[model samples]
Target chain A: MKTFEYRTAAGLAAGLEPGAVFLAGGTNLVDLMKLGVATPDVLVDVNRLPLHEVSGLPDGGIRIGSAVRNSDLAADHRVRTAYPVLSQALLAGASGQLRNMATTGGNLLQRTRCRYFMDATMPCNKHRPGSGCPARDGDHRNLAILGGSPACVATHPSDMAVALAAVDAVVQVDGPAGQRSIPVTGLYRLPEDTPERDTVLEHGELITAVDLPALPVAARSTYRKARDRASYAFAAGSVAAALRVADGLVADVRLAFGAVAPKPWRAYVAEEALRGQPATEERFRAAADAELAAARPLRDNAYKIALIRNLTAAVLTALAEDVR
Target chain B: MRLTVNGAQHHLVGLDPRTTLLDALREHLHLTGAKKGCDHGQCGACTVLLDGRRVNSCLILAITQQDAEVTTVEGLGRRGEPHPVQQGFLDHDGFQCGYCTPGQICSAIGMLDEAGKGWPSAVTEDDDLLSDREIRERMSGNLCRCGAYPAMVPAIRQAAGR
Candidate 1:
């Protein structure tokens, strides 16, 4: 690892600059630095910043401070009771120690687990632009199945962010320009031509908090992740869904997928297909099939389409059964 | 920089900012209880308590933990007076090679605390029972290549009662 200057800032705007990076939980960034993937000139320690609370918003929402640890966020009573999907998603990811050390903002900003990206020796467009993406034709079984480009096909690795996308969470950021809010779904940029750029945030823009809107239907939500192991592994494919049924019909629904795309894929097509439709296995499968119609699976990852389709149907069916 | 470990304060001078907490404990302080299995945080052998919570010491920089209270397996107990968890492990023979015992013990301590606080795991339906499945899921971060998990579950359950 390279030696760098370390500065502890009192506030968000204190010492942020061009090459200076904000360090929060240091789970992802520290690991990446050790792997020589992320090299920052200056490390601004943001642990002492005032952004550590999970407070209630005036609009019946909750504002999660950027530095709030993932374990604390998942254990928060309001999140557990009201936004169970978020809690379940956070618990389903990493492990107890990692969740204890990982922060909300850091979780959202974590990079993909693509082998080509992590390995400095491998040719990855995200690691070094114009180098080439080796994962496109090599070991892409765990790579992206949607929102991929010819340049890159890596999936975003955050299960928590997938749930946030389903719940319509908004991220509050403070930078040199000032403060602004970005919807969680809008926070990430698809890996199009520029796979190097992960998010829409500019350099020195620090995430302050993530606001989750109060949706009562989210209380019935859940998160299901399929992986090689029972725990402590990244999702092969996952679903975050919240369904509300009224009079044997789907009244409202929020759906999102993880480990399938460059970003947390909100299943808007499936949600659109399910609205006002009778809650049944056929309707659920059709909705899932409609959403997955855009999937262009690679040579090794064609199984993901079926896995995700079955998972989507099963999760929605389970949620729908909760009401009957 | 001054670090507080297990209640004692140590003032060290001219330490590199890039030094990880695991290196600081094992090399600088000569406290080798926290072993470095995987420096990338993949293995939990470097697990230690920071501010009463378990975290991968290998991933954390010692300079960043100047305020936290660090705890390792050595701080848990002494000769002839093992911590309840340690005693349970001994009674249940929770290891074959014992390489991952320190991490498993530290992680177990942290997991018990989390369960005590009603923190739910992914498989937790009502937070009522800390079943063997819950224990396995919670301790999934610490991998024992010797496959000592079968005995470790009862060891943890015994420790949980005490």
Candidate 2:
């Protein structure tokens, strides 16, 4: 470990210093540093800056502080009531001890669970610049197919973030330029040529909170994750769905898939297809097919095609029966 | 920086900024009650109470919690007087190596707090209130390598008196 200066910031301005990394929860950043992936010379502790709060907005939305623990945010009554998908997705992630330490902001910024990214010796585009993605031709069974570029195919591993994107949540960020909000959909950029850049956030910019807009459809939401284990595992492919039914017809629908793209893969095309249509297995299957039409799978990832299809069908079927 | 560990207040400076709270408690503060298993956030061996919420100390920076009150396994009880959770674990034989016991106890304490707040788990229905299944689902984040989950439920339930 290298020597570094540690300072506890009093406010966002105090924390956003040059060459200083804002430390919240330290779940992802600390682990990356230990793996020799990230090495910061100065750490700005933002845990005490008073961002840890989860409250209901006057507009019937919810404002979750960036520093709030994943466990707390997932269990919050407002979140569970308004966004059940978010709660379920959070619970599907790492064990209770890790959820207690992981924050909403950190969870959004967590790196991919790619084995190549963690192993420094491996040739990974996400970890090493210009080294190329080994998973592309190698064991890419878990790699992304939707928004991947030729540079990399690493999938975003956050379960809660996918649900947030599906519900059109807004991420509040604070920096030297002042405060601004970015839609969760725009938080991440497509791999394009630079797969190394995971998020659109600028350096020194800190996430303040996530504001989920009022969505009545969210009450009829569901999140289902498919992984190798029954617990304590990352999703291989997951679906977060929010649907509203009126007179046995789909009035509104929103769907987002995780661990299938560089960011949360929202099936807007699929949602549009389901809207104004009768909620039936045939419609659900068509919507799933439409959403996965753009998928470009590599070798050994043919299983994701069936996995995502089944998950999408199951989540939509569950939501179709849920009362708004 | 100052920390009150095991009811003793210690003010120290010039420590590594990247050092984890778990390492600080074990290496510097000499409170080795919390063990370090994975160093990554996957394992629960470094669980401790920071402001009454159980957190993986290995994932937290020592300097981040300068003024925050911390409670380790050692602080939970003295040699003769054990915490209810600890006693529950002992009665249930919740460990073989005992390395994960401290973290399990601390995480259970936090899990009970979460359940008391009426927080829903993954298996919770939108209309249904909490049940034993919800409790188990909520507590799934803490893993026991020894496969003590079967015993853990009764131990936590007995400690929580539910």
Candidate 3:
């Protein structure tokens, strides 16, 4: 790892200089630094910043500070009772130790777990642009099946982001340019020509908080993840769904998928198909299929389609039953 | 930087920003109780308590935790008086190689505190039972290559008074 100068940020705008990186719950950044993937010359400790609260917004929403640990957010009574899906997603992610150290913003900025991306020796477009994407033809079973470009096919490995996308969350940021609010759905970019850039945020932009708008149906939501192990592993495919069935009809529904795309894919197609439709297994399957129709799966990852279909159906079915 | 470990303050100078808390404890302070199984945080061998919460020491930079309180396995208990979790591990023989024991013990101590505070695991279904499945799921970060989970589960259960 490259030696760097470390200093605590006395204020928010102090660490937005070039070649400087904000450090908060260094679980992901430190790991990448050790692998020589991240080489920042200045480390700005953001843990001391005022971004540590999970407070209620005046607009009947929740504003989770960027530095709030994953464990604390998951255990927050407001989140558990109002947004069960977020809590479940956070818990379903990393282990107790990791969740305790990982922060909300850091979790959202997690890099892809593609083997080539992590290994500096391998040829990865995300690691070094124009090099080539080895995962396209090698060990792509866990690669992206949607929103993937020819240059990259890596999946975003974040359960929390999936839930946040489903809830229509918004991220507040402070940067050299200025402060701006980005919808969670618009936060990530497709693995297009530039796979190195994960989010649309600029070099010196810092996330301040995540705003979750209040939705009554969110209280009836849940997150489901399927992985190789029962725990402590990234999702093979996951679903975050919030449904409100009225008179056997889908009144309102929010759906998102994880580990199947370059970003937390809000299932807008499925949501459009499900709204006002009858709450039935056939309809659920058709809605999932409609969203998955655009999936361009690779040879090794065709199984993800079926796995995600089952997961979506099962989650929607459970939510529909709970509402009934 | 000054690190407060187990209620003891240790001041050090000229430390690299790349040094991890685990390296600081094992190398600078000579407290090698926390093992470094996987420096990438894949394994929980470097598990320690930061502000009374379990975290992978290898994943946190030493300079970043200047204001936090760190607790390693050595601070849990001494030989004559073992912590309840340590005693439980001993009574159940929770290890075959003992390489991952320190991490398992520190993690168990922290897990109990979390469970005590009503923090739910992924498998927790609106209850505080602390079942065997819950224990295994909670400790999934700490891998025992020797397959000591069969005994480790009971040890943690006993420690949790289940």
Candidate 4:
């Protein structure tokens, strides 16, 4: 491996190399480097940029610094009490030691854990654009069934991000062209034609923090993941849902799915179906079916459609009950 | 970068950015107690204490960690006396292969510290010490292919004075 210039967060934009990548926790970036998928010449250390604070925003929302470790973010009193879905999503990811080291920025920018993406030998459009996607025909059981173009079919692997989508979180980024705000929904573009771009973030853009608007309905949210194993396994399918039901009528709701799409899929149609509807399993099932109607599954990934349907229905039903 | 590894200060000036804290410890410092089971962060074999917090040394960049008090397995015991965790592991026969032992010990220390700091877990109430089931959940990160969990729990429990 070639050595690169190392510097602190100061003058980060000025010091950017052609292939420079910010090194936060090195959980995903280092692994990608080892796999030859990412060969950055410089790795700027952003761990010491005084961005670890979890502060309360004026909108009654919370602003979480990018450098904050996943463990600290999950255990923060405000996060646990106010955004339990986000906390639960964080806890559901990787092992304890990894979460202890992984920062919020790194976690959000994590590459897919897909086998093809990690193996340089395999033909992957995401790793090497236009090479060809071998996963479409081989070992694609774990790949995406939604928002997949012929060029790519990989899924976003972070659990924390799925919860962020449901709550409509805003990402604050600092780049060469000054600062800009991106909604969580717009952060990840569908893999319609640009399979190479996982996120819409421009090059040299550094995520400073994530701004979360206070949503009381979101406080009742929960993240439930079904994995191959009990621990250290990526989600086979997962749901982040927040439901507010009053007198058996859905007052408000939000829904998002993970490990089922190229990005954290905000179930907009599903939410539209649930809004003002009677809180019941029939309505929940119908909502899930409507959102999944456009899913284009490969030969090996048809199981995910059932998995998402059942899981979404189950989570919505549980959230709809008067169990608060 | 200067590191206070196990209470000893050492300066490394011309290290590569690709060099992990694990490589620095096992190769340069000759502290091989923290085994490199998997070069990737999936395995906890190279676990160590960074400022008294447990982290995978294999993924940590040494240059990024300036002045961090790194406590490895070599630093746990006093001159001739074994650390309580070491003794506990021995008394309970926590390992048959012993490759993941150091990580388990260090991680348990870190886990106990976290519990004292009121960290929550799925199995127990927030901030409580590991219950019998919670022990398995908390230590799930440290994989022991030797199937020594029956004895390992006793060892960690003994060390924790439970």
Candidate 5:
């Protein structure tokens, strides 16, 4: 193994080292390294860099530091009370030991746990640029169904990012050009032309924190995931939603699906269709159908379209019952 | 890289950055109490206490934890005078080939700490009761391939002193 030079981040605006990747909680990075998928020359230690904080924003939202552990984020009082969907999603991911080690920014920047991407011998476009994506016609039962291109069809395996996309969450990044913020929805890009890039982040840019806006609608939110088993499994299909109903009319809603697309697939089209409409299963189905209509599922993952649609309706149905 | 593992400082010079903490503990420090079943964090056989929290040691690089205080299964207790979880495993027959026993013991200790700290599991809806189902869910990380769960649950409950 080619050991890299080690450095620690000095502060929030630390000096960036070339050929470096920040190491927070090595849950995903180290796994990829073991599989020969990622071989960083410099592993910058950022665990003791004083970025662990889950403070409240002036806008009544929450500002979670990038180094905040997933277990701590789920146990936070503010997150559990205000954004239950976020807590639920975090709890539903990985195992207890992994959750204890996984950080917020690490979770956000986690790579796809796709079997094909991790295997270096496989013909994966994401692993090797311009290489044929064998999963396109190979065994891809858990691959992407929405916003997928011919080059790649891997799903983002983070349950936390899916919930963040549901709310107005903004990702904070510190780079050589100073600090800048990007919406969580805009942070990840579809693998249309660039299948190698999982995110829109620059080479040396570091994610600092995530700012979730004041969303009272999230009080009645829920995150529902369906997989092969009950625990320690990635989602086959997942939904994170906040539905507010008024006299049988959909007052407001936010929706995002996981394990179904390249990024955390936010159902903005579904939200647009559900607004001002009656809070009924028919409306929910139509909104989900409208969103899934554009889905180009591969041969094995065509079931995800129906699965996501059913999960959307199910989560909305449970939330609608809360109104009654 | 500097690693203070189980109360001893070991400065491993020229070690590969890809060398896992599990390797540092077992190979370098010669603390073979922690097993390496999967080495991919799936089986959780490399579970250890990293700064008071249980984590898969195989998933962490030794150099990345320059300032960490690692506690392996050897740091828990001895054979005759065993830790509560170890004794529970012995008393309740929580092992078959005894390969995943160390991880199960350490994970049980971490699970108790998490439950005491008001951390809820996916199965824990409202309260943090140490039910059989809750224990199973919280201890899901440490997989006993011997199907030792039927005996493992009571042993974990015994370790928790309930």
Candidate 6:
């Protein structure tokens, strides 16, 4: 491993620096560095500085600091009660040890779990600029179909992030310039051309917290992940659903998918299709199909089409039945 | 950086900045109780307690934990008196190679604390706390390559006295 200088930042202002990478849990960054995927000359440790807080916001929402552990957030009573999808998503990922170390901000900032990205010998645009994505024609069973370009087809490997996007969470960030909040939907950008740039976070910018707006609708939420294994595995297809029913019909619905897109794919079209409609298995199937209509699967990832549709329909049916 | 490890305060300096808490504990401090399997945090062999919360030591920076209280497996049980979880693991034969035992025990302590605090797991209802499904879901992160899950469950249940 390459040696790097490390500094402990006193606060957010002290942490922002050129060529310095902010270290939260280091679960992803350290693993990448060991694999020669990411080699920073300097690491600015941000695990301290008093950012680890999970509290209720004045606007009846919740503000979770970037340093808050995934385990803590998942265990938070308010999150469990109001946003069960978020808690379930967090729990579905990694292991107890990892969730304890992984922070909400780090979970969002985690890189794609594409095998090509990790293997330095492989040609991956997301890892090495201008190299190209080998997974497009290679083992792409786990690659993305939505919002992917010829340059890259890597899927975002975050369960919590997908749930957060489904609920329209706001990411609070601090940078050398100033502080600002970006909607979680707008945080991730499509591969388009620059697969190297995964998120809209600026240089020297640090994610301070994530603010999830109050949605009573999300009180009846669920997250379901289907993977190759029953436990401790990455998702092949996952769905996060936050639905509200009124008068025997769907009042509101927020749906997002993982392992099928470059970012968390919010099923806005499906949500629109469900509004004011009777909550039925047939309607859920239709909504799932509507959301996946635009999916462009690769040569080997065609199974994701069916996997996503079935998983989405199952999650929606469970939500409709109020089965948690 | 100064930290309280296993109730003993130790001052460390001039260590590798990129060195993880796992490396610091096992390599530098000779606290070899926490094993390093799959150093990528996928395995729970390097689990430890930081400020009463269980975390994968492989993912934590040594410098980032300045002055924090750390508990390793060595600190978890006395030389003669083993912790309830440790005793339970031994009684239930929760390991074959015993490589992931320290992490499993450390994680179980944290998991029991979470259950005691009325924290609900994924399958838990919004109103209820600590169900069998919740225990299983919350404990899913720890993997036993030896396939000792059946024994591990009973061990954890005994430790939690559920």
Which regions of candidate 4 are displaced past 4 Å? A11-15, A322-324, B124-129
Worst 10 residues of 3 chain A by lDDT: A9-18
Candidate 3 per-residue C-alpha lDDT over A42-121 given as tens digits, one digit per residue, 9 for 90 to 100: 88888988999999999889999999999999999999999999999999998999999899999999899999999988
Q: Compared with the true structure, what per-residue lDDT tens digits does model 5 show for residues A1-324?
A: 455677777676664666678889989988887788887887777888767999989989999999999999999989988999999999999988899899999999989877889898887888889878888878889999888888988899999999999997999999777999999999998999688999998887889999999999998898999999878999999999999999999999999999999899999999999999999998999999999999887878989988888999999999999998
Model 1 sits at an interface RMSD, in angstroms, of 0.6
User: Which scores higher on DockQ, 4 or 6?
Assistant: 4
Clashing pairs in 6: A95-B141, A96-B141
lDDT of 1 by residue, A73-163 (tens): 9999999989999999999999899999999999999999999999988889998999999887799999998999999999999999999
Where is model 3 more than 4 Å wrong at Cα? none
lDDT of 5 by residue, B100-156 (tens): 988888888888898989887777766746999999888888888889999999998
For model 2, the superposed segments whose C-alpha errors exceed 4 Å read A13-18, B125-136
Q: Candidate 6 chain B: minimum summed lDDT over ten consecutive residues — where?
A: B126-135
How accurate locally is residue A316 in candidate 4, as Cα lDDT from 0 to 100?
83
Model 3 misses residue B38 by how many Å? Answer: 1.1
Better lDDT candidate (1, 2): 1
Instruction: After the best TM-score superposition of candidate 4, give how far the Cα of residue A31 lies from its true spot, in angstroms.
Output: 1.5
Interface RMSD of 4: 1.4
List TM-score per model, in order.
Answer: 0.99, 0.94, 0.99, 0.96, 0.97, 0.94
Per-residue accuracy of model 2 over B17-91 as CA lDDT, tens digit each: 777899899999888888898888777888898877888898887877777889998888778988888888888
Candidate 5 residue spans exceeding 4 A from truth = A15-18
For the record, the alpha-carbon RMSD of candidate 3 to the native fold, in angstroms, is 1.0
Q: Give the 10-residue window scoring lowest on summed lDDT in candidate 6 chain A.
A: A10-19
Error of 5 at A324 (Å): 1.7
Writing each residue's lDDT as its tens digit, candidate 1 over B93-141 gives 9999888999999999999999999898988976564799998988988
Worst 10 residues of 5 chain A by lDDT: A10-19
